[model samples]
Target: MSGHSKWHNIQKTKGAADAKRSAAFTKIAKEIIVAVKQGGSGDPANNSRLATVIAKAKAANMPNDNIKRTIDKALGAGNTDNYESVTYEGYGPCGVAVIVEALTDNRQRTAPEIRHYFDKFGKGMGAQGCVSWSFDRKGVIVISNEDEELDEDTVMMDALDSGAEDFSADGPVFEITTDPDAFNDVVAALEKKGYTFESAELEMVPQNYVTMTGEDDVKNMEKLLDMLDDNEDVQNVWHNWQQD
Candidate 1:
């Protein structure tokens, strides 16, 4: 099992219902657009990437109407957004590895902005594969068990039977890990068994966590992540920072 609890970082966004929620919706919408364009289909049944993005959108509490409208817009002839997926990897304060995933139409504008955030908050951005070597790309599905209504052992076995690579009880959630290629299958299999996910997405999971010893380092890290989260181009940020 992973040493760090998957749900710890999710706690950071518990109270966000204003600008953050809107920003999340916008990011997910952009992701839907890109997924539809790249996958060549508006229907999730035929488009695995779009299905993954839709699951992510639903996890973020994005409305079903918003999702339908975004998919319809993506299918429209007048829609001309040509956003490409870009990933930025570097180190945050206290040598914590950081990865930022963005969907942007302009690489020129998004690259420097990410670099600036790193420069202002931690060590300057590094070349690709610098910090990424420390992480594994996996499909992570988190199911809420807050009320203890779900049985952990049963869920774990079910996940494993459904082709999940690993399973763990992360506090109030059941975390299931699957290979990136088999992610959609595992998610669909679990869904068929009447499981609902609190979050389901492909993520760069750190192999180990780094704890910040300095107060200044902690503040800088928090600021850096906040800036990344608020940026419209940035869709997801992954880090090795152990959240308290």
Candidate 2:
């Protein structure tokens, strides 16, 4: 887990979605709609993609009513607009590889906006597979270390037995990565063992990390990331930025 991952955990601890956290809720809603449409099933029990989105929504403390509404919209759709899942690969300041995953009704609108963000920061968007080649998609589960009294070995055993691919310890938290196809089963097993985690979702992890040393470049990179985060169409952003 990295600081960005830790930040998400901390946000949950702070109850960041207390009716006033519109931004997070909006993102989760979009994901739910897209997942439902793509999965071809509004039922979370049968659809792993929908289940993952629901898991993320639950982790964010999003209201149950809101989640249900989004699912309904996806299922009872008389609309013609279909949200196309797209991944745009680019680099940020200091040559930090960036990947933006979006669900859009129009690629015509999203392409140039994503490109503009890179250009504004003096970076150019790369071809579709350029930066994505450096990353692998995996299911990430984050667990807390408060009063649970679990060590790296214990966590590893639990995750590995449930078909988890890897585990990493970052400070007080443990990161669990599983095969994308086996994510739901692994989560269910961990839950059966009374392992309550902070969040579980599919994520893009870089094969190698890039460290930014200078303060100025770090600030610029932060700015670029913030800009991407502010975009409603952008569902998730992954990067190789490792602070030194």
Weakest 10 consecutive residues of candidate 1 by summed lDDT: 10-19
Clashing pairs in 2: none
The sequence of per-residue lDDT tens digits that candidate 2 reaches over residues 83-140 is 8888998888788898899988889999899899888873789998989988888888
Candidate no. 2 TM-score: 0.86
- Where in model 1 is the C-alpha error above 4 Å? 1-4, 13-19
At residue 204, candidate 1 shows an lDDT of 89
Off by more than 4 A, model 2: 1-20, 77-81, 146-148
Please list the C-alpha lDDT of all candidates, in the order they appear.
0.87, 0.79
Write the residue-wise lDDT of candidate 1 on 138-193 in tens digits: 99999999999998889989999999998888788888889998898998899899
Model 2 clash count equals 0
TM-score of predicted model 1?
A: 0.94
Model 2 score (lDDT): 0.79
